[model samples]
Target: MRKPIAPRTIRGRLLCPRVDTRTVDHLADGLVEIDEQGVIAAVGPAPAGCAVPETVPGTVWLPGFVDTHVHYPQLRVAGRSSGELLTWLERTVFAEESRFADKNYATDVAADLCRRFIASGTTTASIYGSSHPIATAVLFAALDRTGLRAQVGMTLMDRDAPPDLCLEADAALVACEALIARWHGHDDDRLRFCVTPRFALSCTPRLLEGAGRLADRHDLPIQTHLSENPGEIAAVAARFPEAAHYLDVYARHGLCTERSLFGHCIHLSEPEWGALHAAGAAVAHCPDSNFFLGSGVMPLRDTLTRGVRVGLGSDVGAGRTFSMRHIAASAYDASLLRGARVGPEELLWLATAGGANALGLGDRIGHLAPGYDADLVAVQVQVSDPADTAELLDALLFSHATEPVRNVLVRGRRAV
Candidate 1:
């Protein structure tokens, strides 16, 4: 097998903030030295003996942003918000997702989504594919061709979704196991498996239990939805009468572990927060989707104070944008609406390192530090109105397509 090589010279005005949970730092006029194989060798001042490449100015370099949660099959249906979460799913999402059964269609949209993500400065994402294994495989193939680092999983729903989207419980588990065996840890671990169950309402106890078993056996990360909206919660409550709450359904099935990533945790209860913190599971705070669907704002401050791990998600389709910049901006607005404010540093951390941590990839991706993958982005700063550099960073927290992401590198190679 051929090995990947790093760039001879990666010249730019680097803007990496230390995204560690312990402390954060922002560096300007920085330069990153990449080794032969696409990984960061050094970051900061160019060494004395090194041949310096011509500098590229007027662009801010950042570690490629990580999106903790997104649905690949729903990429084409962005901004289709007519009603709340459940209604939107039935009226638009499920119907559009069902089209992934066509392999050609799946391949085309997968490539489109990958391009959109790169254009927005995101280098990695955890994505959910359609239930069809062939469709999921096509999505993976598209990502492989596109050069984005991703954990892509086939969506498993035994019930409640559209008839074409649903799968039999045992059959779905078998397919998931086969996929893991084939794709987990592929491409030097750039591509991975995420055992995905659509959600509690779409899955029966048998399916969730089987999925948990498969995940344990393969040691794969798990992804699913939680208490996203009142209607969805009510539907879950109605379906699982024996469970205490929405989280309880996953908890009882052993799906609430540190490796599990629950998306759209907007309307969670106090006990659910406690359980999530105790379980060491991560939450993907998808503010744009919540706002678009008319769902409640996520309790970001409360979750943080409770010591729960949180990251950002561009819950595309419902989220209306592929950029984590949009998600970060929406997050700040969501926090303000909930009577708490997130500073620029914190918001940047959420989009980069916080997201890496949420996906259990903190040490591997999401930073410009040595030993991390050389996944970086160059963003052109163009403030619409009068704003200083400090305000520019904050503007990224809530603006729409204001700045252009000029370059994207994944694994030391140019991606966009």
Candidate 2:
């Protein structure tokens, strides 16, 4: 991978999600100075005696999106509308993921995935790779080339999967360890390894326990699915009859912790919500995916009121788009269907700062403030009235077509 270029200053209409207020902050005319180390040195009005550069007449600068859940191997299969979750996986997802066993094929797909991420303004994402170690390595290499921050893991499923995608517990653990050594914390910690067990139905007790042990030993984060659909939940209960509930199975295996990110938590119960809050685990709300699969809408109000951390995810393939803005719109619609109203501030927060907090990287990359990583996106704005920031944001979110992103910067270097 090539080294990033020297830092520079950018002046624009700055917009960011603030943690203190849990809202989006807009600065009509602002300057952001990045240091040589790819950190934000200062953010606000231009410094005294500093040379003021020309500003784009109508552009909005905001932190690059943080997509908390996505599947790297399923990129090609995205937008294939089929039956519900389990049937969709059997018909489309499994067949598509099985292609990743070829390293060359995986490499080619990885390039496309990274380019899509840049085009969609996603600077950071937590990715799920197919159950092939070589394929996962190829993905890391591709992401490293683009300087995109990410957490990737080899999908682990020792049972109920096609033989080509299944690995025994011991072999899976060894592969994960090797991946951790080779890629975890690589590239100045921009890349990370996650312990991903494709979810309970596909994993045996031994596999889940082994995954938890490996994660604890390496201090790595864990990602998995939970209660995405009714049939899936019933299958989990049938598979683990002794467990009190679906969450208990993971908790007993030492997988329920602050670093755990469970995706598509649509059918969770009240007690399950409490368990998540108590364990400090986070949820990745893939609303578009839920809508596509006919999965029930998640109760966003209940989850937030219970103090559980929630972030937005593309859940690509299952999710319709790579753009977090589209996901944000879906979230709003999902919330409304559940009798809750989500405003623009909350939606933007879920896409950026909320995702950072969910992935335990809030201080590093979510906000466009001093000391944060300089990951940002510049969007062309054609609003007739530039004075109303809220109106501009609403137009961007609700419109059928969004203006193309003018530029993207990651780690103080221009990425697109």
Candidate 3:
């Protein structure tokens, strides 16, 4: 077990997503008292009977970013591309993922992935492991030691994949069940198990249905890809001819629930958007990946107008950077490309609170309010004027692509 953080109070300049509004709350000079259990005990001006606080200058305290979608096995594949989605996956992605079948390789990569996440200021993430169950187990063990919060799953694919990477349906389900028994809700629910079907094109109906049953039996969240590319959408339509659209394929199998997180809704029609809204499912809008692979921009306004929950994803390998700031900047550009305007507050919310809310972790990790986990990132930023929070944030998102994340704390224990 990881060592516990000692309870203490911190005083700094705070900028965080407000619980009830779309904007951020700027406590220019504020105090946050953390209890022994690493939960926030107070927020605002210093409480009565407090000691002289330790202060850090030129630093801004914000909620550690929550990355809703990332592929653990693809960390090394980040800048490599094959022009588009399906072809890219076949040529580069699949070949790279096949390396995870080696347990030693998986362990080394898992440790490196956790280190990069911490360095990039991502506190919580929903991760996709390769189809190897032992490799997936290695990932969980690595995360357990690193102290990052995550929901990890073994990618389930029974067809349309390399033979060594695909598992039979029965064996896949058994592996998932065993993984859930061992890792789900482990470490005070900081480490979780997500049932992942690679996507409709790669998974047969039997495999998708069995994956849904496992998610339902464990009441776990489900993560998978959706209409990411035009070619991919057409292939799903050809594969599931009985379904109305791509989203309907998983909906028919009971996978479209509030806990379902569908990555890349970039090619959806009106009816498909309606289905997602009706199902109360969330979307991980991977603008960076879309831009990198020449996939069309996601219609951010239409999806939000339809009342579907949405968050940003780095989608690394396909996504160019691990920084949530880069994701937010890309999302801002994608929104403008679609003729919609997105403010920095909204983009920051997507990176932090919106992601937590989408993943059903809203009440615990998103904000710095009382009773919330003390997961925070301290970034070194110089603010000459206190009222320039908006301008400061704008520069941070668009200009400071490689800003140093000075410290990262999960449950008040420093991780980086």
Candidate 4:
């Protein structure tokens, strides 16, 4: 049997986005108390009679990064770019995914995936499994063992792909139902099952419709790709000729709800932007993957201007690395290329608080606060001896490639 964790208080020089706003809250000296339930019971400077706090383990403590989109099976496929998104999928991605049918192979990779998440300082995420249900099950079991909070989905691809990788809509839904029964709401709801259609080009109309209805019945979150590439967009148009636009194809099948998360929305039309805002949906801006695959830069400003919820996604395999901080660094580059001046505070928010909000877990896990889960990272990062918030953020993001995560805590439990 597992032993109960003891409650403790820790002091730190911390910086995190506010739970109520995008602003960062920094304290050169601060204290936080985590209760037996693994919730932050108190957080602030020492009050009178608040037992002298223990020092934090790293240079600064920030809320753990939340990755809004990524693929579990593609962990080993990073950096094998084949010129474009669709061609890369055909040449590099699907072949790697097909190996997941071997349960042993899937299990080994899942363990590595969890380690990478911990090493990179991600406590919460939305992940994609390969089309195989057992492979997705393998992914969930690994996440559960590691104590990470994530929403995982099995990719649903019924048509327009290789036969070995494709399963009919009804069969795929049956597989999904089984996975849901086993993993949904497991372990005090730390993990959830998301409905994932592999986009319009890969899914049959039946698969898309059934996925939408299943999510409605189960009240689950949904994740899928959107207008990331122009060629891919044209193909989606050809595949769903009757639909109004790329986003409308999802809307037609009831998948464009507030619970939906669309990745790489680069070439969205004005009306599509309006629709995303009106539906109260969210977006996963995978700038690293966009640049890696020659997919055009997403107009980050357009998504922000529409007041749509947006979060950073590593979008790995194609996206270079699993670190969301690296993705945040790339987001700045993408923004600069698009002629937008997205601030460091905002980028920090997007990597942590904004991602949790995008995943609809804002109050539960985003920022450092009393009543929030102690899901945070301790990074050994510094540009100045006692770096201010801006200097700290810049160093953390810009030096992400080398500055490793010093410590990680999930619900106050040490995960690394």
Predictions in order: lDDT: 0.83, 0.89, 0.88, 0.89
- Judge candidate 1 at residue 319 and give its lDDT: 86
Candidate 3 lDDT over 1-416, as tens digits, reads 43566887888888878877657888877898888778899889655665746466667788899888999889889988677999899988988899999999999999998998998899999999889999999999999888899999999999998998999999999999999999999988989999999899889899999988988988999999999999999899988999999999999998999999999999888798888998899999899999999999998877777767787889988998888989999999999999998878888887888889889998998898998999998877755674688877876688654668888988888774
lDDT per residue as tens, model 2, 327-412: 99999999899998887778888889999989999889889899898999888767777768778778667767877877788888
lDDT of 1 by residue, 41-90 (tens): 88875556546763555676788898988998888889876788888888
Using Cα atoms with residue i matched to residue i, what is each candidate's TM-score against the true structure?
0.94, 0.97, 0.97, 0.97
Give the lowest summed-lDDT range of ten residues in model 3. 46-55
Give each model's clash number: 4, 0, 0, 0
What are the runs in model 4 whose C-alpha is more than 4 Å off? 1-4, 47-54
Q: What is the lDDT of residue 119 in candidate 2?
A: 90
Q: Which prediction has more favorable lDDT, 3 or 4? A: 4
State the local distance difference test value for candidate 1. 0.83
**Whole-model lDDT for model 3 versus the true structure?**
0.88
Decoy 3 TM-score against native:
0.97
